[model samples]
Target chain A: QVRNELALANAQELINKINEKCFSKCITKPGNKLDSSEQTCVAKCMDRYMEAWNIVSRAYISRVQRESQGESL
Target chain B: KELGKFLESENARMRLQQSIHTFTDLCWDKCINKISNKIDRGEETCLTNCVERFLDTSLFIVKRLEETRKKL
Candidate 1:
């Protein structure tokens, strides 16, 4: 219930961040269409962003566990 | 209660979101230079290492701060 809503909100935030970051990086010119090159750039940027997200999540989780272990010791 | 669990999960989600934003900024600065539409092996490795080292730096700062606080 509440958790689902929170997850949705977080996802929305990420989407907004992606739009801001990738749009700036990929779309130098707003052509009639997204243009093939621009579309490809956006696609790749999204993929790389996801990869970065996972890497950060893993690093953060392990650091947290280590810190908690130290607290108990 | 169910409400307590929901709140716990919500906190976790928020934390995850915050970290994602921070890392996106950090790694985006390092790994992404232009719209190449393809991440090379070197950039991918840099992104991974950027995240790991950022966390390490954060932990190191916290530990240093704690020590400083103890001295004060």
Candidate 2:
């Protein structure tokens, strides 16, 4: 129950970051609708952003484990 | 370590929370050139190395600062 709420909050925060970053990177000019290119860019950007998050998560987790083990930084 | 047990430590939880934001922002700039459907191999490698060296630099600085402070 508590863990689920924490996960929800984390997901919300990630969504906010994706919107802010992708908006600037994808939406240069306002159009009547999201043009094909902009839509594609946003879709790709979302995936890449999540990938970036995962990469960091894995690296940091391992580093933390190493630190806890008294391994030299 | 168990995720639930790890979260029980406030210090560990908070440090992780802070580090994730720092690492994500730092690595995003270093690794991401333009958003693409998939992260290329080169970019993926850069992100991992970026995190490792970043922590290395941070530890180095802290050690340097402590030594200098002891001299004062």
Candidate 3:
């Protein structure tokens, strides 16, 4: 239970960092406090960042697998 | 040797992830030019290629440095 909670906290911290980055990228100006369009942009940016993260993760994994195979051969 | 091996593996893992984060930041700037509802195919491809090329660049530099060290 403690481990799970700690993991959750770490995950939340990462999410917060992601949110901060994506929000800054998507929202250029502090227009009248987050209009509907800005909110939508934030949502989409978050999704896109997650997708990029996954893509990068998979690409790195595959590259490692290839290199290890080459090393063994 | 065992302690060194453990530290080396941990260092490698951290470096790999750090390079990915750096690549993501660079490619995000290049590929993600606009704010959109979905990540288009172009952007996806760009991100993947960016990581691959970045790794290649790092490896190439490391190999060159090792060769230089051998000569010295």
For candidate 2, list the clashing residue pairs, or say none: none
Descending-DockQ candidate ranking: 2, 1, 3
- Candidate 3 residues B1-72, lDDT tens each? 997887677667656666666666677777788767778899899988988898899999999999999999
- lDDT per residue for candidate 2 within A35-60, as digits (tens), equals 99998999999889888899888998
Tens digit per residue, CA lDDT, model 1, B1-72: 998887887787788678877887778788778655456778777876887788788879999999999999
Interface RMSD of each: 2.3, 1.8, 3.4
True-vs-predicted CA distance for residue B5, candidate 1, Å? 4.6
User: Can you give the lDDT of residue B22 in candidate 1?
Assistant: 81
Q: lDDT tens digits, residues A1-73, model 1? A: 7667777887887788778888998887788889887888888888777766776677667767887899999
Top candidate on TM-score is 2
Model 1's alpha-carbon lDDT is 0.78
Candidate 3: tens digits of C-alpha lDDT, residues A1-73: 4446545654565486567777888678787788888878788887887778778889888998999999999
Strongest candidate by DockQ = 2
The TM-score, computed over Cα atoms with residue i paired to residue i, of candidate 2 is 0.83
Q: Which wins on DockQ, candidate 1 or candidate 2?
A: 2
The DockQ figures for the candidates are: 0.51, 0.61, 0.46
User: C-alpha displacement of A28 in model 2, angstroms?
Assistant: 1.7
Tell how far residue A14 is off in model 1, in angstroms. Answer: 1.7
